[model samples]
Target chain A: MNARRLAEEIFVPHRLVMIAVAIGLLVWAGMAMRWHWIPRYYDLALQGLWRTIWLLGLSCLFGFMLAVPLGLAQAAGPRILAAPARAFCTVIRGTPILLQLWLIYYGIGSLFPQFPWIRESELWPYLRQAWPYALLALTLSFAGYEGEVMRGAFKSVPGGQLEAARSMGMGRFAIFRRIWFPQALQRALPTLGGETVLQLKATPLVATITVIDIYAVSSRVRQDTFIIYEPLLLLALIYLVIAGALALAFKLLEQRFNRGMVG
Target chain B: MLDWLYALWPGLETSVGLLSLQPPGWGGNLLRGAVASLQIALGAFALGLVIGTFGALGKLHGGPVTRDLLSVYTVVVRAVPELILILILYYAGTDLLNQALQAMGRRPVEISGVVAGIAVLGIVQGAYATEVLRGAIQSVPRGQLEAARAYGMGSVQVLRRVTFPAMLPLALPGLSNLWLIATKDTALLAIVGFSELTLETRQAAGSTRAYFTFFLAAGAIYLTMTLVSARLFNWIEARYRRGQVRQ
Candidate 1:
């Protein structure tokens, strides 16, 4: 065999064997816990993972919806609209997400019961829960950062193209719908993906407020088992897999968006 | 309607009433926390710059193995939650060190929360800085470096005189953003019980059940710091671009 092929054969087997051993060790740990704890830790982790996913999904969805108008205002006409939106973005982006989460959960939450209308309202039940406050904080955080990104993306869409659309008898909103939004979104996809990953990371802070997300579950399991590294390592691995999947999906979407555009 | 709006404002209670001059030392406690947060962020930012510069340089000029390792570090750091990494690193670092000490028949060493916090923040910040600095380094014209080398300057000299200065302007925006992130990441250290702003706010709020007061104070302090730093970074950027023609 040639030298390169020989080197590959020698190196490749060791990597595969290492991978097998790691997986084996991981399985052994889980099985050990399952037998010792009566499947308790496993159940908790699964539930936590699900909660984290749903939390991330809802916050990102609503945040995106909120961001669109805020972002448009940032890049579109009047100073009145842009100024407040800019300030909103600044304050949100400037502070820590954890602080915001706490402010919403403990800060605003304590105040909710004091208001007669809010206390008597149907939505108060949900608002009183930690999850809603978590959701509120996460949604606002996402909108703030993502709104700025979308604003930058909006400004990046060439003015010439907008002028061309205008000359073609397109109404302002029509031009935005047809030309501005898509192009801006396409360009912003990569940054948005990073922000989404950040949003996923931010979900764990909700755990601090007793939301029972993945991080909270792992922390609980760790406290119970007195096995800190394994649960935390497993948590990291789960996040890695999710982030990898997101990065790959973004790449595919980016390629699809750029298909006809000249390099 | 005005009354209703006012009622929604939490009624100047202890929690949201810090500015009303009721609580004796509550505001002082939060201000101290903000200062601690700033100190931690500044330390972490310095460490991050060093780590980022080296990582960027390694990625730029090192062999395939070095590049691959740095790439893995960036990817993993970027992917994982900061909270998870901090907790793991804090616990595992102490554990591993204690194990090593036992092996060597030496006394075990405890890692301080402050040291651990700075180290973790620096590490994560380095991953992002590496990417930012790498781009900045790439943006510096190849011709400038080539000319420096042709003048018989050593590699280190070329980097010092040409590469670092040229990349500063390009790197400023990303670096400043990283600084902001570093400041914010200090709050994460509070989870590990570091007595930064957020943790202090939590303590104050919990003790007094005045959640809105302490946190609002904390948030406003953080906002002030952010704004001040934003202006500082902007001024630095302007200084960097002084001689260059605006596009």
Candidate 2:
């Protein structure tokens, strides 16, 4: 297609209409802010944004760490080990993350109160906090997803390469460290990047459990000010910007990893 | 523990009473809530199928503008967290439309929970569905279309008889996945005070404080629904694939 046609196709009327509607809503929101119909709570917004960032960062770190070994085990372990791991992955994958969060936060807390070790530990205080519950839920959920992605990537590594490494008299650990891990990491980057973006979006669910993320803050702003769309629109725009940037960064990383493969 | 297990076996007799058909009993309420959840899912899935089919068609055939439009729609809808979408659609949807109508000197609008739930879920499902449908349509052999044209079939006729039927077998699996997602997302609609199974379970748990029992029951309901639907999808898939063979 020609450039003009391409542009036109990309800017189709339905989408344009939606964007126009969004812009109109934003303009109305701005007017609401100007007239003090919507309160300007810059501090809360900033704090909420920071909380969102921290939640995503910590959750992704923990999730990825847990995922790597679990994924490797699932891909390579004996039947006894792999069966339970596979079942764990399947159950986590099949169930709703929100339900899992609710169950862990409330059910475990209420059920296991009499366990002395749990009650006496320093970790109790952290575990008792809603944020930790949120973190645990997000981490476990993403671990399941990323584990599957890693498993696929590991399987995709050519058998000949591993055989070649073994034939060269390299130890298993050395071969895995030098050959398998790097190649699998490269192969898994795109999927992992997508999951990271997903995790960013998923962090807002933390607000439902009272973790005071950006969406929660926005909801509070709406509740306090009785201004409906402004806070949500602003929050949505912030999310869009973050997600779009992540998409671009991942695309660049993918291209870098794929540099020599295509040509 | 053995004695306790024996007692619990007889204690299971009261399980029926626990499921009795009255207030303070779960049987009626849980069943009703499950039905409502199913209704919400069905509505969302139907709407998603409609939106997805058209969106996919536009993406595949409408040129670059359409493709880009679909791309943005898919990206934005998918990237925005489902919970946030539910909240925005549930609360702001009502307020914004009502205010807009009032500003226009018209009657105010009320967005019902069912409508809001379906709208949000349908939009969410459509994002994935668009990709599925687009892929399925693109996978249809170009030669088939050319053959149809040679037979003097019009575009509409070709779509109806040749393209759509061919796409259906390929699209069925993806559509099934979207259906499962929509079904699961009905759980989120409980936040908006929808009397779905999850909300009913929450209410039961709050009142009885048997949080474990109620939540376990809710999980069971979800699992049952998922398994049943999965079987149904599998049957349909088998039926669809009957005449086809692997090359």
Candidate 3:
């Protein structure tokens, strides 16, 4: 990426001082910062990190699955489907996801036990758990945001490709699977990556619902140990690392997508 | 609570009763929370815009150290989640201030939640706003800046009269998006037990056993704010866009 050359080009004298100051701060943090609690919480922190990752991954997967139909409905469906789809995206996008999370978890979660069949069902135990409600809210929130992105992606697809597919005897579903969906997905991929990081940021909201993700664990650490800065700083570093890796992965994915397409 | 209101309008007995502005009804509390949310959002947005303008300008026109420092701030703030940032910033900020006060032999003052919330969200908003404004400022036609200089205006004068206004139209959409983000981000303060709309709704719904009602009402309030803000931004954009190049 020519990072070395670029850094050399931009390395003015004051910038050097800035770099040195940053390094010094890190060193001070390492040498002088608190550390007595790490051994106790590290195990739980790891588990919390795992929970956060899975919540991010599964919800994004499920959400994108939901978004495809929502996007398609908004882009090309009849008024009946499109209006409701549009309304869903608008309402979801407008409100805070924290509100939505509480709505699903507390609002709908409280309602479930009121029904006799829900209590009697085999899935009742899972439904009674907090993670499912967390998952549901996260999934719906993702679907809402991505639905708008996908709508733009769908609308932006070259009309000629669809016309050509139709002339070649491709049915609507076949055309969608082959040319339409792929192109839309490729177009949506960049925004999808950015939104995924936002989803990662949002995974912490489950903590509010008592789902014990990484942020929740950190908060618990603070409550128990009466230490605040160390845990939160660690949490920030973890998030930064994950966000960086995710960014790099998306960059590679974008490169691959570009490679498969002829110029 | 809503005897007069119900008398004025029939068949709204239950749902309307839940939202009455009088005692035993939480509608007034929710509205107060909405006002608090708006205050925070508005204060944060203005503060962020100020920081963003400077950050963007520094990135664009300042020295290498300034650019690098601003970039670091933006990147770090953007990568981390706001909830974590709020937690860290809210406490750390207040603690640092008190320590500074103690060092100066002054008694530490309690930091108000609204002010702290504004400052924390403002910092977050500033990062996003910087990116938006930097792009917007860059989108200003270079020729316009040159022309202002051509007219014998000093650097500050050029920025005041030409660069800022020239960039407004291009920057409006991104800035507006950030405003909406600011409003939504205030809900994160609910974690810190700030009395914002989301937390207020939770308390109301918790007490009432009417979770769907209060939460949905809060949602509607947020939605309305967003739509209204969109309209307001559009009007501001149109106002600034008089007699400009259209394409």
Q: Best candidate per DockQ, number? A: 3
lDDT of 1 by residue, B100-197 (tens): 99999999987877778888888889899999999999999899999999999999899899998898999999999999998999999888888888
Give the C-alpha miss distance for residue A39 in model 1, angstroms: 3.6
Q: By lDDT, who's the top model here? A: 3
Question: Per-residue lDDT for A256 in model 1?
Answer: 91
Q: What is the model-wide C-alpha lDDT for candidate 1? A: 0.87
Question: Tens digit of lDDT per residue, candidate 3, span B1-247?
Answer: 7688888766457666788889888999999999999999999999999999999999998987788889989989999999999988988999999999999999999999999999999999999999999998888878888888999999999988998888889999999999999999999999999999999999999988888889999999999999999999999999999999798
Candidate achieving higher lDDT, 1 or 2: 1
Give Cα distance to truth, residue B20, candidate 1, Å.
Answer: 8.8
Write one digit per residue (lDDT tens) for candidate 2, span B4-106: 7558687454544556678657868888888988998999998888899889889877876577768888988877878777767767678788999999999
Q: Give the C-alpha miss distance for residue A147 in model 3, angstroms.
A: 0.7
Q: For candidate 1, give the lDDT of residue A63.
A: 96
Q: How high is the CA lDDT of each candidate model?
A: 0.87, 0.81, 0.93
- Per-prediction TM-score, chain A only? 0.87, 0.84, 0.94
DockQ, each predicted model = 0.65, 0.41, 0.77
Ranking by TM-score: 3, 1, 2
Give per-model TM-scores: 0.90, 0.86, 0.95
C-alpha lDDT of candidate 3 relative to the true structure: 0.93
